[model samples]
Target: MLLVEDEDSLREILREFFENRGYEVIAVRSGEEALEVISNKKFQIGLFDLKLPGMDGIELARRARENDPDMLVLIMTGYPSEESVKKAAESGVYDYIVKPFRLEELEKIIEQVTKEWRMSRENRRLRKKLADLEGEIW
Candidate 1:
Protein backbone atom coordinates (compact mmCIF):
# COMPACT_ATOMS: atom_id res chain seq x y z
CA MET A 1 0.00 0.00 0.00
CA LEU A 2 1.10 3.55 -0.74
CA LEU A 3 -0.12 6.29 1.59
CA VAL A 4 0.36 9.99 0.82
CA GLU A 5 -0.80 12.46 3.45
CA ASP A 6 0.45 15.90 4.40
CA GLU A 7 -0.66 15.81 8.03
CA ASP A 8 2.04 14.34 10.23
CA SER A 9 -0.14 12.83 12.94
CA LEU A 10 -2.70 11.43 10.53
CA ARG A 11 0.03 9.97 8.34
CA GLU A 12 1.64 8.19 11.26
CA ILE A 13 -1.69 7.01 12.60
CA LEU A 14 -2.78 5.63 9.25
CA ARG A 15 0.61 4.05 8.63
CA GLU A 16 0.50 2.29 11.99
CA PHE A 17 -3.11 1.33 11.56
CA PHE A 18 -2.58 -0.39 8.20
CA GLU A 19 0.73 -1.88 9.29
CA ASN A 20 -0.99 -3.45 12.28
CA ARG A 21 -3.56 -4.89 9.90
CA GLY A 22 -0.78 -6.80 8.07
CA TYR A 23 -0.31 -4.34 5.25
CA GLU A 24 3.14 -3.29 4.11
CA VAL A 25 2.65 0.46 3.83
CA ILE A 26 4.91 3.12 2.33
CA ALA A 27 3.79 6.46 3.77
CA VAL A 28 4.98 9.75 2.32
CA ARG A 29 4.32 13.42 3.04
CA SER A 30 3.92 14.75 -0.50
CA GLY A 31 2.84 13.61 -3.93
CA GLU A 32 6.35 14.18 -5.23
CA GLU A 33 7.71 11.74 -2.72
CA ALA A 34 4.96 9.31 -3.58
CA LEU A 35 5.84 9.58 -7.25
CA GLU A 36 9.46 8.84 -6.47
CA VAL A 37 8.43 5.70 -4.63
CA ILE A 38 5.87 4.74 -7.24
CA SER A 39 8.56 4.73 -9.91
CA ASN A 40 10.50 2.06 -8.04
CA LYS A 41 7.75 0.07 -6.37
CA LYS A 42 4.38 -1.18 -7.54
CA PHE A 43 1.56 -0.96 -5.03
CA GLN A 44 -1.79 -2.68 -5.40
CA ILE A 45 -3.57 0.13 -3.57
CA GLY A 46 -2.84 3.81 -3.01
CA LEU A 47 -4.50 6.12 -0.45
CA PHE A 48 -3.82 9.76 -1.27
CA ASP A 49 -4.90 12.99 0.39
CA LEU A 50 -6.72 15.21 -2.11
CA LYS A 51 -4.61 18.21 -1.29
CA LEU A 52 -0.82 18.01 -1.20
CA PRO A 53 2.14 20.40 -1.12
CA GLY A 54 2.83 19.78 -4.82
CA MET A 55 0.86 17.64 -7.27
CA ASP A 56 -2.60 17.07 -5.82
CA GLY A 57 -4.15 13.66 -5.37
CA ILE A 58 -6.04 13.70 -8.65
CA GLU A 59 -2.91 14.39 -10.65
CA LEU A 60 -0.94 11.92 -8.66
CA ALA A 61 -3.53 9.23 -9.17
CA ARG A 62 -3.61 9.88 -12.91
CA ARG A 63 0.14 9.73 -13.17
CA ALA A 64 0.35 6.72 -10.97
CA ARG A 65 -2.14 4.89 -13.15
CA GLU A 66 -0.03 5.74 -16.16
CA ASN A 67 2.82 3.94 -14.45
CA ASP A 68 0.70 1.02 -13.28
CA PRO A 69 -2.80 0.72 -14.65
CA ASP A 70 -3.66 -2.03 -12.20
CA MET A 71 -2.97 0.19 -9.21
CA LEU A 72 -6.17 1.10 -7.34
CA VAL A 73 -6.38 4.69 -6.11
CA LEU A 74 -8.48 6.12 -3.27
CA ILE A 75 -8.61 9.86 -2.65
CA MET A 76 -8.94 11.25 0.88
CA THR A 77 -10.20 14.75 1.37
CA GLY A 78 -11.04 16.80 4.43
CA TYR A 79 -12.49 19.54 2.24
CA PRO A 80 -14.59 17.90 -0.41
CA SER A 81 -15.77 19.91 -3.35
CA GLU A 82 -18.06 18.90 -6.19
CA GLU A 83 -15.50 19.91 -8.77
CA SER A 84 -12.74 18.04 -7.05
CA VAL A 85 -14.87 14.95 -6.72
CA LYS A 86 -15.69 15.05 -10.41
CA LYS A 87 -12.03 15.53 -11.21
CA ALA A 88 -11.10 12.58 -9.08
CA ALA A 89 -13.50 10.40 -11.02
CA GLU A 90 -12.02 11.65 -14.27
CA SER A 91 -8.60 10.71 -12.98
CA GLY A 92 -9.73 7.10 -12.48
CA VAL A 93 -9.65 7.11 -8.69
CA TYR A 94 -11.26 3.99 -7.28
CA ASP A 95 -13.01 5.81 -4.41
CA TYR A 96 -13.21 9.11 -2.55
CA ILE A 97 -12.97 9.01 1.24
CA VAL A 98 -14.03 11.98 3.31
CA LYS A 99 -11.72 12.67 6.22
CA PRO A 100 -12.73 12.50 9.90
CA PHE A 101 -14.24 9.19 8.95
CA ARG A 102 -14.39 6.07 11.05
CA LEU A 103 -11.49 3.70 10.75
CA GLU A 104 -13.88 0.82 10.26
CA GLU A 105 -15.40 2.53 7.25
CA LEU A 106 -12.01 2.86 5.63
CA GLU A 107 -11.19 -0.70 6.54
CA LYS A 108 -14.35 -1.99 4.90
CA ILE A 109 -13.62 -0.10 1.73
CA ILE A 110 -10.07 -1.39 1.72
CA GLU A 111 -11.23 -4.96 2.21
CA GLN A 112 -13.67 -4.83 -0.66
CA VAL A 113 -11.23 -3.16 -2.96
CA THR A 114 -8.49 -5.57 -2.00
CA LYS A 115 -10.67 -8.54 -2.83
CA GLU A 116 -11.55 -7.15 -6.23
CA TRP A 117 -7.93 -6.28 -6.92
CA ARG A 118 -6.82 -9.79 -6.12
CA MET A 119 -9.46 -11.24 -8.36
CA SER A 120 -8.42 -9.00 -11.23
CA ARG A 121 -4.81 -9.98 -10.78
CA GLU A 122 -5.69 -13.63 -10.85
CA ASN A 123 -7.79 -13.14 -13.93
CA ARG A 124 -4.90 -11.49 -15.75
CA ARG A 125 -2.54 -14.23 -14.78
CA LEU A 126 -4.95 -16.87 -16.02
CA ARG A 127 -5.42 -15.08 -19.31
CA LYS A 128 -1.67 -14.90 -19.85
CA LYS A 129 -1.27 -18.57 -19.03
CA LEU A 130 -4.05 -19.48 -21.41
CA ALA A 131 -2.43 -17.50 -24.19
CA ASP A 132 0.88 -19.18 -23.55
CA LEU A 133 -0.69 -22.61 -23.64
CA GLU A 134 -2.50 -21.79 -26.89
CA GLY A 135 0.80 -20.67 -28.37
CA GLU A 136 2.46 -23.93 -27.37
CA ILE A 137 -0.40 -25.98 -28.87
CA TRP A 138 -0.23 -24.05 -32.13
Candidate 2:
Protein backbone atom coordinates (compact mmCIF):
# COMPACT_ATOMS: atom_id res chain seq x y z
CA MET A 1 0.00 0.00 0.00
CA LEU A 2 1.05 3.59 -0.62
CA LEU A 3 0.33 6.04 2.19
CA VAL A 4 0.65 9.77 1.48
CA GLU A 5 0.26 12.38 4.18
CA ASP A 6 2.10 15.67 4.70
CA GLU A 7 2.10 15.86 8.48
CA ASP A 8 5.14 14.14 9.90
CA SER A 9 3.56 12.67 13.02
CA LEU A 10 0.48 11.43 11.27
CA ARG A 11 2.54 9.86 8.53
CA GLU A 12 4.69 8.04 11.03
CA ILE A 13 1.71 6.87 13.03
CA LEU A 14 -0.12 5.56 9.99
CA ARG A 15 3.00 3.89 8.70
CA GLU A 16 3.43 2.12 11.99
CA PHE A 17 -0.24 1.21 12.24
CA PHE A 18 -0.34 -0.41 8.82
CA GLU A 19 3.05 -1.96 9.18
CA ASN A 20 2.10 -3.53 12.47
CA ARG A 21 -0.77 -5.18 10.65
CA GLY A 22 1.73 -6.68 8.14
CA TYR A 23 1.05 -4.18 5.38
CA GLU A 24 3.99 -3.22 3.24
CA VAL A 25 3.52 0.54 3.39
CA ILE A 26 5.47 3.04 1.39
CA ALA A 27 4.74 6.34 3.07
CA VAL A 28 5.59 9.71 1.58
CA ARG A 29 5.07 13.36 2.55
CA SER A 30 3.91 14.87 -0.74
CA GLY A 31 2.24 13.95 -3.98
CA GLU A 32 5.45 14.68 -5.88
CA GLU A 33 7.28 12.20 -3.77
CA ALA A 34 4.45 9.71 -4.21
CA LEU A 35 4.62 10.11 -7.96
CA GLU A 36 8.36 9.54 -7.91
CA VAL A 37 8.01 6.51 -5.67
CA ILE A 38 5.12 5.04 -7.60
CA SER A 39 7.02 5.44 -10.82
CA ASN A 40 9.23 2.63 -9.64
CA LYS A 41 6.63 0.59 -7.81
CA LYS A 42 2.93 -0.27 -7.74
CA PHE A 43 0.58 -0.41 -4.80
CA GLN A 44 -2.70 -2.29 -4.40
CA ILE A 45 -4.20 0.57 -2.42
CA GLY A 46 -3.45 4.25 -1.79
CA LEU A 47 -4.31 6.31 1.29
CA PHE A 48 -3.88 9.96 0.33
CA ASP A 49 -4.58 13.22 2.12
CA LEU A 50 -6.53 15.62 -0.04
CA LYS A 51 -4.91 18.85 1.06
CA LEU A 52 -1.34 18.05 0.20
CA PRO A 53 1.35 20.69 -0.12
CA GLY A 54 2.11 19.96 -3.75
CA MET A 55 0.04 18.14 -6.39
CA ASP A 56 -2.97 17.47 -4.21
CA GLY A 57 -4.49 14.07 -3.60
CA ILE A 58 -6.96 14.25 -6.46
CA GLU A 59 -4.19 14.59 -9.01
CA LEU A 60 -2.20 11.93 -7.29
CA ALA A 61 -5.17 9.60 -7.37
CA ARG A 62 -5.55 10.19 -11.07
CA ARG A 63 -1.91 9.40 -11.72
CA ALA A 64 -2.00 6.42 -9.44
CA ARG A 65 -4.99 4.97 -11.28
CA GLU A 66 -3.18 5.58 -14.54
CA ASN A 67 -0.26 3.57 -13.25
CA ASP A 68 -2.44 0.81 -11.85
CA PRO A 69 -6.00 0.95 -13.06
CA ASP A 70 -7.20 -1.55 -10.47
CA MET A 71 -5.65 0.28 -7.53
CA LEU A 72 -8.09 1.33 -4.80
CA VAL A 73 -7.70 4.99 -3.69
CA LEU A 74 -9.08 6.44 -0.49
CA ILE A 75 -8.98 10.16 0.09
CA MET A 76 -8.58 11.70 3.54
CA THR A 77 -9.17 15.32 4.42
CA GLY A 78 -9.39 17.46 7.52
CA TYR A 79 -11.20 20.05 5.44
CA PRO A 80 -13.81 18.75 3.07
CA SER A 81 -15.64 20.74 0.43
CA GLU A 82 -18.10 20.12 -2.36
CA GLU A 83 -15.48 20.90 -4.99
CA SER A 84 -12.98 18.53 -3.46
CA VAL A 85 -15.53 15.76 -3.23
CA LYS A 86 -16.51 16.25 -6.84
CA LYS A 87 -12.87 16.28 -7.88
CA ALA A 88 -12.20 13.15 -5.90
CA ALA A 89 -15.09 11.37 -7.54
CA GLU A 90 -13.82 12.44 -10.93
CA SER A 91 -10.43 11.08 -10.01
CA GLY A 92 -12.03 7.66 -9.33
CA VAL A 93 -11.36 7.60 -5.62
CA TYR A 94 -12.73 4.43 -4.00
CA ASP A 95 -13.85 6.27 -0.90
CA TYR A 96 -13.60 9.55 1.10
CA ILE A 97 -12.51 9.47 4.70
CA VAL A 98 -12.65 12.39 7.08
CA LYS A 99 -9.79 13.25 9.35
CA PRO A 100 -9.70 11.94 12.91
CA PHE A 101 -11.10 8.68 11.63
CA ARG A 102 -10.83 5.58 13.72
CA LEU A 103 -8.13 3.16 12.73
CA GLU A 104 -10.63 0.32 12.78
CA GLU A 105 -12.89 2.19 10.41
CA LEU A 106 -10.02 2.75 7.99
CA GLU A 107 -9.12 -0.90 8.23
CA LYS A 108 -12.65 -1.95 7.40
CA ILE A 109 -12.75 0.38 4.45
CA ILE A 110 -9.49 -1.02 3.18
CA GLU A 111 -10.81 -4.55 3.39
CA GLN A 112 -14.00 -3.65 1.61
CA VAL A 113 -12.22 -1.84 -1.20
CA THR A 114 -9.72 -4.63 -1.75
CA LYS A 115 -12.44 -7.24 -1.70
CA GLU A 116 -14.44 -5.38 -4.30
CA TRP A 117 -11.38 -4.91 -6.48
CA ARG A 118 -10.61 -8.61 -6.35
CA MET A 119 -14.18 -9.53 -7.18
CA SER A 120 -14.21 -7.18 -10.13
CA ARG A 121 -10.98 -8.60 -11.45
CA GLU A 122 -12.30 -12.09 -11.12
CA ASN A 123 -15.47 -11.19 -12.99
CA ARG A 124 -13.43 -9.67 -15.79
CA ARG A 125 -11.27 -12.74 -16.04
CA LEU A 126 -14.31 -14.99 -16.22
CA ARG A 127 -15.85 -12.87 -18.90
CA LYS A 128 -12.70 -13.07 -20.95
CA LYS A 129 -12.55 -16.81 -20.55
CA LEU A 130 -16.15 -17.19 -21.67
CA ALA A 131 -15.48 -15.01 -24.67
CA ASP A 132 -12.50 -17.09 -25.64
CA LEU A 133 -14.49 -20.31 -25.36
CA GLU A 134 -17.29 -18.85 -27.47
CA GLY A 135 -14.81 -17.87 -30.15
CA GLU A 136 -13.36 -21.36 -30.18
CA ILE A 137 -16.80 -22.99 -30.44
CA TRP A 138 -17.87 -20.62 -33.25
Candidate 3:
Protein backbone atom coordinates (compact mmCIF):
# COMPACT_ATOMS: atom_id res chain seq x y z
CA MET A 1 0.00 0.00 0.00
CA LEU A 2 1.07 3.59 -0.73
CA LEU A 3 -0.07 6.17 1.81
CA VAL A 4 0.25 9.89 1.00
CA GLU A 5 -0.50 12.47 3.67
CA ASP A 6 0.88 15.94 4.26
CA GLU A 7 0.28 16.09 7.99
CA ASP A 8 3.19 14.50 9.76
CA SER A 9 1.20 13.35 12.79
CA LEU A 10 -1.56 11.70 10.81
CA ARG A 11 0.95 10.24 8.41
CA GLU A 12 2.86 8.53 11.18
CA ILE A 13 -0.33 7.37 12.87
CA LEU A 14 -1.70 5.82 9.68
CA ARG A 15 1.65 4.32 8.74
CA GLU A 16 1.90 2.57 12.08
CA PHE A 17 -1.73 1.57 11.99
CA PHE A 18 -1.50 -0.07 8.58
CA GLU A 19 1.92 -1.56 9.25
CA ASN A 20 0.68 -3.20 12.43
CA ARG A 21 -2.01 -4.86 10.36
CA GLY A 22 0.70 -6.55 8.22
CA TYR A 23 0.62 -4.19 5.28
CA GLU A 24 3.98 -3.24 3.80
CA VAL A 25 3.16 0.40 3.53
CA ILE A 26 5.27 2.99 1.74
CA ALA A 27 4.12 6.15 3.45
CA VAL A 28 5.13 9.57 2.10
CA ARG A 29 4.49 13.19 3.07
CA SER A 30 3.74 14.66 -0.32
CA GLY A 31 2.27 13.72 -3.68
CA GLU A 32 5.65 14.31 -5.34
CA GLU A 33 7.19 11.72 -3.07
CA ALA A 34 4.28 9.41 -3.72
CA LEU A 35 4.82 9.79 -7.46
CA GLU A 36 8.48 8.93 -7.09
CA VAL A 37 7.58 5.75 -5.24
CA ILE A 38 4.75 4.87 -7.61
CA SER A 39 7.14 4.97 -10.55
CA ASN A 40 9.24 2.21 -9.03
CA LYS A 41 6.71 0.11 -7.15
CA LYS A 42 3.30 -1.14 -8.03
CA PHE A 43 0.79 -1.10 -5.19
CA GLN A 44 -2.50 -2.91 -5.09
CA ILE A 45 -4.07 -0.06 -3.17
CA GLY A 46 -3.19 3.62 -2.69
CA LEU A 47 -4.59 5.64 0.23
CA PHE A 48 -4.12 9.37 -0.37
CA ASP A 49 -5.05 12.45 1.61
CA LEU A 50 -7.09 14.80 -0.55
CA LYS A 51 -5.14 17.85 0.54
CA LEU A 52 -1.44 17.62 -0.23
CA PRO A 53 1.15 20.35 -0.56
CA GLY A 54 2.40 20.07 -4.15
CA MET A 55 0.18 17.72 -6.09
CA ASP A 56 -3.21 17.14 -4.53
CA GLY A 57 -4.52 13.63 -3.91
CA ILE A 58 -6.86 13.70 -6.89
CA GLU A 59 -4.05 14.49 -9.34
CA LEU A 60 -1.82 11.97 -7.63
CA ALA A 61 -4.48 9.31 -8.03
CA ARG A 62 -4.79 10.15 -11.71
CA ARG A 63 -1.07 9.91 -12.28
CA ALA A 64 -0.87 6.73 -10.22
CA ARG A 65 -3.48 5.21 -12.47
CA GLU A 66 -1.46 6.19 -15.53
CA ASN A 67 1.48 4.32 -14.04
CA ASP A 68 -0.49 1.36 -12.65
CA PRO A 69 -3.91 1.11 -14.14
CA ASP A 70 -4.81 -1.70 -11.78
CA MET A 71 -4.14 0.22 -8.59
CA LEU A 72 -7.14 0.89 -6.35
CA VAL A 73 -7.21 4.49 -5.05
CA LEU A 74 -8.93 5.66 -1.88
CA ILE A 75 -8.91 9.32 -0.93
CA MET A 76 -8.90 10.59 2.67
CA THR A 77 -10.24 14.05 3.21
CA GLY A 78 -11.00 16.21 6.22
CA TYR A 79 -13.22 18.42 4.10
CA PRO A 80 -15.21 17.10 1.18
CA SER A 81 -16.59 19.40 -1.44
CA GLU A 82 -18.62 18.93 -4.60
CA GLU A 83 -15.51 19.82 -6.55
CA SER A 84 -13.50 17.17 -4.78
CA VAL A 85 -16.21 14.60 -5.37
CA LYS A 86 -16.26 15.43 -9.05
CA LYS A 87 -12.49 15.20 -9.22
CA ALA A 88 -12.46 11.89 -7.34
CA ALA A 89 -14.95 10.45 -9.81
CA GLU A 90 -12.89 11.75 -12.72
CA SER A 91 -9.74 10.28 -11.20
CA GLY A 92 -11.25 6.80 -10.91
CA VAL A 93 -10.85 6.52 -7.16
CA TYR A 94 -12.31 3.50 -5.43
CA ASP A 95 -13.76 5.63 -2.64
CA TYR A 96 -13.35 8.79 -0.53
CA ILE A 97 -12.86 8.38 3.21
CA VAL A 98 -13.64 11.17 5.62
CA LYS A 99 -10.91 12.00 8.11
CA PRO A 100 -11.35 11.27 11.83
CA PHE A 101 -12.72 7.98 10.60
CA ARG A 102 -12.85 4.95 12.83
CA LEU A 103 -9.93 2.60 12.31
CA GLU A 104 -12.37 -0.27 12.26
CA GLU A 105 -14.23 1.29 9.38
CA LEU A 106 -11.00 1.83 7.47
CA GLU A 107 -10.03 -1.77 8.06
CA LYS A 108 -13.33 -2.91 6.59
CA ILE A 109 -12.95 -0.59 3.62
CA ILE A 110 -9.44 -1.85 3.01
CA GLU A 111 -10.63 -5.44 3.09
CA GLN A 112 -13.34 -4.64 0.56
CA VAL A 113 -10.93 -2.72 -1.67
CA THR A 114 -8.44 -5.54 -1.62
CA LYS A 115 -11.15 -7.99 -2.65
CA GLU A 116 -12.19 -5.68 -5.46
CA TRP A 117 -8.62 -5.36 -6.63
CA ARG A 118 -8.17 -9.12 -6.74
CA MET A 119 -11.38 -9.55 -8.67
CA SER A 120 -10.38 -6.86 -11.15
CA ARG A 121 -6.99 -8.47 -11.66
CA GLU A 122 -8.57 -11.85 -12.24
CA ASN A 123 -11.03 -10.36 -14.69
CA ARG A 124 -8.22 -8.75 -16.67
CA ARG A 125 -6.31 -12.01 -16.77
CA LEU A 126 -9.38 -13.89 -17.95
CA ARG A 127 -10.04 -11.35 -20.65
CA LYS A 128 -6.52 -11.66 -21.95
CA LYS A 129 -6.81 -15.42 -21.99
CA LEU A 130 -10.07 -15.25 -23.89
CA ALA A 131 -8.59 -12.89 -26.40
CA ASP A 132 -5.63 -15.17 -26.93
CA LEU A 133 -7.92 -18.15 -27.44
CA GLU A 134 -10.04 -16.23 -29.89
CA GLY A 135 -6.94 -15.23 -31.86
CA GLU A 136 -5.83 -18.88 -32.03
CA ILE A 137 -9.29 -20.01 -33.14
CA TRP A 138 -9.47 -17.48 -35.93
Please name the candidate that would achieve the greatest TM-score relative to the true structure.
3
Q: What is the C-alpha lDDT of each candidate?
A: 0.96, 0.93, 0.94
lDDT of 2 by residue, 1-138 (tens): 899999999999999998998889999999999999989997889999998997999999999999889889999999999999999999999899999999999988988887898898899899999999999999
- The order of the candidates by lDDT, greatest first, is 1, 3, 2
Give per-model TM-scores: 0.95, 0.94, 0.96
The digit string of per-residue lDDT tens for model 3 on 18-116 reads 899999999999999999999889999999999999889999999999999999999999999999999999999999998889988998999899999
Best by lDDT: 1
lDDT of 1 by residue, 22-119 (tens): 99999999999999999999999999999999899999999999999999999999999999999999999999999889988999999998999999
| Model 2, C-alpha of 70: deviation from truth (Å) | 0.7
| Model 2: how far residue 73 lies from native, Å | 0.5
List candidate 1 segments past 4 Å from native: none
- Between the candidate structures 2 and 3, which one is better when assessed by TM-score? 3
Better of 1 and 3 by lDDT: 1
Residue pairs with colliding backbones in model 2 are: none
Candidate 2 CA-lDDT value: 0.93
Count of clashing residue pairs in every prediction? 0, 0, 0
